[model samples]
Target: MSSSNKQAGSLNEKAGISSPEITNASAISQIKNKRRQQPSAEELISGIISGNRTTLSRAITLIESTNQDHTEKANQVIKGCLSEANKSIRIGITGVPGVGKSTFIEAFGKHLTSLGKKVAVLAVDPSSSLSHGSILGDKTRMEELVKDENAFIRPSASGETLGGVARKTRESIILCEAAGFDVIIIETVGVGQSETAVHSMVDFFLLLKISGAGDELQGIKRGIMEMADAIVINKADGDNIKKANLAKIEFNRALHLFPSKKSTWQPKVTTCSAITKDGISDIWETISQYFELTHETGYFDEKRKEQNQFWMIETINEHLKSDFFNNPKILSQLDETKKAVQNNEISPFAAAQILLDKYKKI
Candidate 1:
């Protein structure tokens, strides 16, 4: 074995964990000695742009990794695929639980695919310690749709965040676009107004509602409603058709009461039944119209640019926080600083500055 391989093996054994270096070296050696070929990042990017499922999955994994060293390579892959991205219509869907959000998506996604459009569904489930790393089982709710050749489904856990969305959902959207998906649907857990995280990244915000007697409005939070580009009254078929119509009118009135969006686009309210497949097409048409009007008025590009800026700022802040907290000296001093502040020996502000200064010197 090579020196690096031996060192990697020793580290893995000492740490009682599988070392990534060892795994990577083994992969490289296998490719060279057995497969006789290795795929480059450019090849992966090209394959992703061409809609290869395998490449798309790999690209998403790369972007979602928290490993520091993988970031540069991940960024390179994203940049190479960037020009081929941003073609998809990005949509954010949220609603209270039992409102049929998953069913609606499954139906809507199938509808889009039937129209010969490639669809990517990113379902953001609230993360729990027990289930954080596992793929959400909600895809089973989208069984038939999941089986569609042109549809891609990725269920991401929110990771101790209220939004039940991964921080990388925005980056995942870019990857999906590069993978040639025509429509990218982001589904958030229907837990009150906190779900608005999806709103910032999508072109249209869709709120799914179930018609309940006057209680519909009670379940709807003002913050969430204000961010909605469209309110969908789901489960509109069977015995609830009349009630659904009433609920739609009520929501429309409530929507009108709110000031118009900054983009000058009026939010629309409609009713649909995923079970009976009613009004799904009209919902799709409304989304298309919203995109058309927004694009024509230049808001589409402007909104995307703003989102890009927001992500840049957020990423920088995250990097600074991670770097500061991970520094060995800062970490070692954290307890002492906290105790000093508690004992009134140093003010919190001064303690913070001291730590920051220490970090700067390091």
Candidate 2:
């Protein structure tokens, strides 16, 4: 032992007091979180399907990787897991900052686990557009849920995506489902396009709002309000109870102004206090009722199929857009086209057509 530690131990011994060893919790946690041993893609697929949480987590990390080989491997893992997907209750939750999303998720996830359900949370944390930095910090907030044996929580950075969701969230959901999670909750990076991106992949979309904020209409846009299957007014306890109820009424009235959805399920509004664990069950009951009604209507399966088709087209569009922009011919002419358009030597449409023709020739 070092002299300082020996002296301290000697003093404790002389005083008949036992000394306890200390641990560096944060350092130990960081060491354990290091990337696991790399295995074959087949191994990863099999491990995930076998319900290995570490392997499942590694598979998600692989999918989130930017490396080309990692991406190819990730695709193989996703392909192997497809048959196991479309079996869970996919719910997307979104609200502005400070709306208690993380707290609600922890409470809600624990509730699900209590009912013998496996819950997976895909939380998107905002990333800096320039430096590509993000804390991916929401996991730290859900200490209890993180320790739950049946729960898996992954915090992803929403880098450069306008929707404020990870680019590979859909693939992550498939991996989670293949790992046998029955409840998949996607928490967005606050409101806006992130909610819509989440809505495209989820079976039900829920918008969380708070009270004493312009009656719950100040921050939320009309389209988002219309897309919400349920609007929850959080912080309903203590002094906020009356305000929460009033906000709930206003939200319900506003939702009534929108046309009915194709699924025939009318949107609803309610209040909840995540801190006190009050009304959490009611919100879940609302989700259960939604699933029951949608399944009975056959809209549930139809929506999933529609989502698949949408993603197929989206993939093609993204691929073609990337290919076109990355073409050397397009790059060579882009500056020329811009100059011509700016100098009035050629119309913008004409310049675009010229570049398109040049790209086609190449």
In order of appearance, the predictions have TM-scores of 0.84, 0.85
Q: Write the per-residue lDDT of candidate 1 for residues 1-362, one digit (tens) a residue.
A: 44454443333455334456535866655655655443567887888888898888877877778888778878888889889888989999988778888899999999999999999999887766785675588788999998999999998777765557786888889889989899999998777644666878999999888886457778768888888889999998888999999998988889889997878889999999999998999999999899888989999999999988988997898789878988889999999999999999999999999999999899
Residues 37-97 of candidate 2 have per-residue lDDT tens digits of: 4788899989988999989988998998866567678889999998988789999999999
Q: Provide the global lDDT of candidate 1 against the true structure.
A: 0.85
Model 2 ranges off by over 4 Å: 1-37, 328-352
lDDT of each: 0.85, 0.87
Which candidate wins on lDDT?
Answer: 2
State the number of backbone clashes in model 2: 0
Pairs of residues at least 3 apart in sequence or in different chains that clash in candidate 1: none
